[model samples]
Target: MFRSVLVANRGEIACRIFRTARRMGLRTIAVYSEADANALHVREADEAVLIGPAPARESYLDQARVLTAAKATGAEAIHPGYGFLSENAEFAEAVMAAGLTWIGAPPASIRAMGLKDAAKSLMVEAGVPVTPGYMGKDQSPERLKAEADAIGYPVLIKAVAGGGGKGMRRVDEASAFLDALASCQREAASSFGDDRVLIEKYILSPRHIEVQVFGDAHGEVVHLFERDCSLQRRHQKVIEEAPAPGMDEATRQAVTAAAVRAARAVNYVGAGTIEFIADGTEGLRADRIWFMEMNTRLQVEHPVTEMITGQDLVEWQLRVAAGEPLPLKQDQLSIAGWAMEARLYAEDPANGFLPSIGRLDHFVLPDDIRVDTGVEAGGEVSQFYDPMIAKLIVHEETREAAAQALADACADIEVWPVRTNAGFLVRCLEHQRFAAGDVDTGLIGAEEAALTDARPSDAVIQDASDLLWRSRNVDPNDVWDAEYGAPGFRLNAARVTRQTFFVDGVRHQAPYENNHPVVRYGPQIDGGFVVFHGGDAYAVSRHAPRGAGGGGASDGSLRAPMPGKIVAAPARSGDAVTKGQPIVVLEAMKMEHALVAPFDGVVGEIGVSVGDQVAADAVLAVVASTS
Candidate 1:
């Protein structure tokens, strides 16, 4: 094994790689940008180096800086931990050119699969089933439109160089093709610097099932079963599981064999994933699944596969990079138990899942399951990176047990201020359809109402009120202080101390009286207290007194819902726009959000333009009531 390996990434994946490297007695080096100077991964590494500024282009994605840090730290190998530079073929070659071992697939293999159009062609030649689509090189808009028409409506316009759902749009008709193409192209150029696209038939009932494939320098390849990544939102995976719930032995064998064949086609080495889109309208079958794309590095959901197979994939990567043969043959690998993983992101489901950036006031994870995270209590979640807080993985003897355990863990989280989709995740796992394994890529969208309608129960609200009352009156120095009656209350008369709170935007008042029994609140943190009641926890902080200022703007204003860059301003000042017409496009957290005109009116003062960064609640434009 290499003496020391430098992790050329950030966040949880970096920490995860370091853990495995340390266990193998290999020294680990971490590279960080200014934003991650005090990050947990930096603190955990044996040695750390500052690469560049906070922006990814200046730091994490800068090849020269990463190589310099690795060389300066005397790292014998560099592990690109699944983002940024993980799939960059040029970066892989450059690392090898610098006389450092690259702990990933061969640069040739990466190049082969880097472009979707080319990869699909390669898969077809290798006898792997592929979805019908257009992979032509003609860049004319008319050509793409014609192809879309031939493929029929409801076709997917996908960036040839895109991942993580960026640069993808689904067009339902010819009338919408041009607009979707423009949006997809803009996103593609911004994300991958390549606007080339491919057209594919959008599967109505799609189930994303990917097989984990590994190869060695000795020309040996093996399969590690598969993961069901069907639970998704906005084309991004939210939950994943191993040994797909409805998978049978025959289907598994067929998919795994196809995955190995795909790996061999590229002479692939190290860890890679062959993702397939299955038609689940009927049921999972070998013939119904088709190749979608291949991820050329360790996946984010590798933990679920690890739990079921009892193997450390990172260890395999290290050994293979060190010129070792395959750890085990395909026949020796077997699924042990079912496992599930839920990605907890710092995003608010109530606000259209907008990414939230702030300090973690009271971060806590369940102790019963495995949590892979790079942030801790008091950690700052910066706006320069992905907003995923952690990946919670659970294992059990059965899929139902695993799902229930994962759901409970999500509900048990006690994060404050920073909004999360924890409640939504819990609902997804507990939903009748999900529990029965009738899952698909559209599951979240179909059941969004149940998943996101998380309102604090009355009992929870009452507990919060009581806790707030006690926090103000109870003396911290004296635990038995009984002077905790509501202020200005007499001995016999009933007094009601009304406290107001906003839960999901709606205001609620809970009254507390000195006559009622004191409800114990948890220990106070810096900014808030965590209250538990009726098996649910609520993070409560005293609301700041409202000022005399007017309650925000009227419905005529188009304000930014979150901090982001203004990518487009279609309606200029003095331009008339109809209600629900897109006026501004804000790009944040690698996704675009369109802010529309609230009513039919003429645009007035335009406060922001393209390429301007604005904070949350900043008014982007004003619409005078023309009605």
Candidate 2:
């Protein structure tokens, strides 16, 4: 089944594992970096290499340049498509010591679920329940605060080595448990150099719910069910779903038989997942679920479990890495509908969601759901990686019609020179406690100002300026064009260029009439045009820019959004700051950024110094306002 596979990973999950290894006829090989050389999964691979430069530890976590570009493109097998070096257990024992075919799972099951304190002690000896707290290995801080005061006052200091919420920490009592365990041991010793920690039990309304296990190499295992992912933010996962909204039927068959007994107690194979943490205060039961960690590979919401198990988990991870086995066990897996996904992320849900790099002018995403994307319409979303940029997904037959068709396909998705959340994921699918599904992980920090309110609507800015003035062909009875109303006057004075735009929170201005079809803007902008008027409807559409060598306006320099370090700055040089104060904090991907004061300021230039590595907007402090 595997003629050539080599996808080691790049964007849109290396074009989503080369579209299931070219629909099973295999032959893929991608590997880029140099900020994904003109990306789009390196122009949809068949072969492509250059595996280095542009960070990600010198190129997608190097590992001998992805085993010499998978044996110089002979490939055979190797599809780690979920975050670089997919659960690297020494790069899956260096692709099974270079003989190829390591299509995932088994580097001793990614080193027995690669360290979340030894996979919660192997999911409590595979009875698979976990999450009680203190998986013990004593890192003495008064015995981890007497085991978080005998597992009571709101615990949770994770990070027994890398997982998104980077070295997590919660501690809601006993005076914030020794400064959140010294800031979760300095962010788990600067992100998984392993500062070792484990104290759980802070499940106060958690939801996550993962499952979707699969296996083969003949030991067989199956479950392909569950995937709620509780729409999180800091604990990563931006949105996901599939058979989970109030799941019943005997707790979804005891959480899919304890996620196929935690993937047959890690003899697991191909497409993994597990991750539980359920108990939403008291809802999805199977004795209130637990075990929170076991991704191993393939799950950046694997297309909402492949749109509710219609199956194609990377062509069943290349038909179980070419030795096929369990094709339909676990009673032929069936869920059939309701799927969702979201995760668009160029980042800027009103700036706290940070991470937004540049150039992607009018990338237009959403042609009826299922996006996936690796950046197009001219790419460059760089900041060295993981700004996500696409995922969308959707499928219906329920779950409130797949959350109202992913909120009308994210209000008709459209990205322009970088700026999206697609209107903050259409206000988190019209929020109201996420349309009353009562999700958690602080549901976007509890409706974060109505989901980063960028506020758009004077009828959606007169329909984004009458769809940008009928895409610039604005002919209002063409009297020599300009919308046909110009030449007015006895005193030769017809001024109208009063711009002041700000939609959603409303504040518009468009006083254009200096001449014909030049009327500021308005007419239910749904497909394009958006003439300005100060109230902010500039939309316009079809620009297609990408790295912007010419299209300007985003390089003034203000970097650092995820990937931390640089705690506290109070910008000095002429200090006058105002527009949203707090001047410099950064500290990358593990979250904590401030670098504010964008307007009404005075600190003209500071260019990062407190241990600077800055990327996302790279120019630390350069205010200069009084325009």
Candidate 3:
């Protein structure tokens, strides 16, 4: 067995791996960037090393530095905790060549499943059902478009080398195929250094069902059931649960068996995921589900699988790396109950769901649920990494109970200044369709406006108003002076103070009254009270409610949604534009956000060009209104 392990990653997963390693009595080592030097994960490690600066390319993804740190720290094994270099086959081989254990799938397995096109071919040869798509190697734009035509409209163009929802696009018609393909290829080239792509028939009602598979060197592989990650937005998973709802035993058997077959085909070892996309218009069936790709590493949502199966996946990985036999035979393991996990990200849903980065002044997660995070109250969410702050996991006897518990936990979260998607997550979990188990990948997109509602209810307003009134000082001898038009008291009673607050940049006016309601409020920050209602933070502050309220008409300037690099400027100066036409596509935090035209007008000014670095609120273009 290995005596020490170094995690070649950052954030919650690193902390998670350290926990299991410590329990097994293995010395823990953490590698951090300069930005994460004071992170919680570093503090939790027995030994920590600084690899490089803030940018991941220079820090977390620098293979040589990570390997050197492991060697210097006497780490017997390197656990690439899911991201960074986890699935890099060459890096895995390099670790083994350096006479250190690599705690992941074999290099051969990673190479076999590295590309979507090649992996799908492998799955087909393994006698597993794969989605109907094009995996041919002809990279010509015309050939790809023809393939899309044959596959029919509404086809998905996915990068052969993509993961984490990057390098993917959907085209609904033949005319739009080329443009979407160009964007997809550009993203793929930028993200994965591979511009090659494959096309798939877009499942209108799709459900992301992935099975967790573990293999040992002794030729044994077992499935840990399946998880439904269909609740998604922009191809990114938002909520995931174990033992997919409405999954019949027959379908489960078929999917799990196929997943095991896929793993055995590559002679895989350690942990991996076999992702399948199901035609979910009908309930999950053996025939409707097919293989999509294989994630040859641990997933971010592995905790729910752990909760349901009652097993430490990291322990399994360690044992497998040490050439141990399977912990339990296929027949011995079974699901204990239902489990759900919600990713708590530092992002603003109202502001086009842009990543919010700053010092976390008041980071408070619920204690009742199992919360895993890598940042504390005084920590900062840097601009150089993913925005996910924590993960909230819950387990119950049934799926219904688990969903409700997880929703309540999300609502109880209290984060200030740095906005979060807690409110959006709560809506998704508590949605009536979600509760009924009638969900698909488009559920979030279909109900995004309602799910991302940034407004607080009337009751919340009343509660905030009451608190604001109580917190203020009332003068004892102020008379109602009508001549001077001053706000004061009458002879017998006091006039209600007009409580005004600025919420979401809009002024909310209400009378201050003595009424109590169950409302959660965060600590005072920047002279305002943060009212946490239904998972949304309302930064309420006095605005005086004076004059004819503030601003006027629009200037039609489109600004950068967040700090990012402008990848494409589709709209040039003097171009005719519509209200929602795509003007600039900015890539940030490993995802693409399209900044569109504000209203129907002509593009008067183009402030950014392709490859230009931009900051949040930096004007990218201006539209001159015609009407």
Candidate 4:
């Protein structure tokens, strides 16, 4: 084993890697940018080094800085913990060149599977089934259009060098081809610095199934079963499970064999994932599955596989990088139990799932399950990185039990000031279709309204109101005395005491009799109170009365919903736009949000330009009534 290893990443993955390294008695080093100076990963490492500024390009993605930090810290190996430089073939080669062990697949393997088009061609040549698509090099717009026409409508335009759904668009018809292509290209160039893309036939009723494969220096490879990651939103996985719900013995053997073949084709070493897309319109079978792509590093959802197989993937990575043979042969590995993982992100489902950035005033998770988190109570979710707060994983004897436990765990989370999809996740897990395992990639989209429309029950709302009233009126110094009125006399009065609050932007007034029993409240943090009742918790903030001079902007103003950079301003000043027409596109938290006009009107004073960063609620443009 190596004496020490440096984690060339940030957040939960960094912390996760450190845990395994420390358990193995290996010293761990962490590298951080200015934004993550006080981050949990930095505080947990044995030694830490500041690399560069907050932006990834200046820090995490900078190969020279990372290599220097590793060398300075005397780290014998560097673990690229997914994302950033994890899949960069050049970075891997550079690490090897510096005489430092790279705890990832060989650079040759990474290069082989780096580009989508080239990787598909390689898979085809290797006799592995691949999705039928256009992998040509022609960059002409006409050529792409012709390819799209040949592939038929409802084709997917994917960036040649893209992952995490950044540079992907689905075109339903020829009329939308050019526009979708432009948007896909723009995002691809911005994300991967490669605007080139390929057209693929979009699979309807698609189910994403990926097999976890590991290889060693001795040309030995084995499989760790599979994970069903069909629950997705915007092409990004939201929930994942091991031992796919509907997978049978015959299909499993076929897919696992194919995955091993794919790994051997590249002479792959270390941890990698072979993702396959299945046609679930009928049911999971051997014939309907085709190779989609391969992730050349540890996956975000590897924990589910870990829970079912009773193994640490990071440990495997370290052992293999040290030139050790395979830990176990293919026949030795087997699934134990069912496991599920839900990615908890700091995003608001009510607001089109826009990313929320703020201090985590009250970060708490259920104690019953395993939670891999990056931020704590006082940590900040910044705009410079991914908004995922944590990954909640649960295991049980059965899939239904695991799903229910995961949903309950999500609902039990108490995070304040930073909006999350916790409630939405609960809804998804509890949905009838999801519970029955009748799911696919389009599940979330098909039931989006129900999944995102979860609201607190009336009893929970009343509990919050009661807690707020007691906190405001009851004196902590003297429990017997009431600040508003005498306890006995107030109870005799007929009028009710009204307490106002804003629960998710909607104003609510709770009227209660003075004699009403005081409801118990949890610890108060940052002037906000968390109320618990009926086995549920609600975080409510007192809505202070608007002071004088509050009335300001008109209702027709199109404001930036959150702090972000203006990527495009399609409607200029004096340009006429219809209701719901997009005025500007804002980029934040690595996603695009389009701000649209509130009503049919003419565009007035455009306050922001392309490439300008604006604060939350800052008016980007005003839509004056046409009448």
The candidate that wins on TM-score is 3
**lDDT values of the candidates?**
0.87, 0.73, 0.88, 0.86
TM-score, each model?
Answer: 0.92, 0.32, 0.95, 0.92
- The residue-by-residue lDDT of candidate 1 on 1-627, one tens digit each, is 789999999989999999999999999999999999989999999999999998898999999999999989999999999989999999999999999999999999998999999999999999999999899999679999999999998999999999988999878899999878878888888888899999999999999999999999999999999999999998889999998988999999999999999999999999999999999998999999999999999999999999999999999999999999988998898999899999999988866798888998778788878999999998988888889989999999999899989988887787766777887888888899999999998889888976887667776677666666666765422424344333535568655346675433346777664444322355465445756432234456665324323434465887887788998887889898888788889988777888888778898989998999999899898887787
Per-residue lDDT of candidate 3, residues 201-302 (tens digit): 999899999999999999999999999999988888999999899999999999999999999999989999999999998899999999999999999999
Candidate 4, superposed: residue stretches over 4 Å from native? 472-502, 509-554
Q: All candidates: CA RMSD in angstroms?
A: 3.7, 22.9, 2.6, 3.5
Error of 2 at 274 (Å): 1.0
Model 1 sits at a Cα RMSD from the real structure of 3.7
Most lDDT-accurate candidate: 3
Name the regions of candidate 3 deviating beyond 4 angstroms: 475-497, 544-553
Model 4 whole-model lDDT (C-alpha atoms): 0.86
lDDT of 3: 0.88
lDDT of 2 by residue, 161-259 (tens): 768777787887977687667666766676556777888878878988888888888888888888887878768887888878888889988888888
Q: Residues 508-547, candidate 4: write the lDDT tens digits.
A: 8765534443233655654467654322345577754343
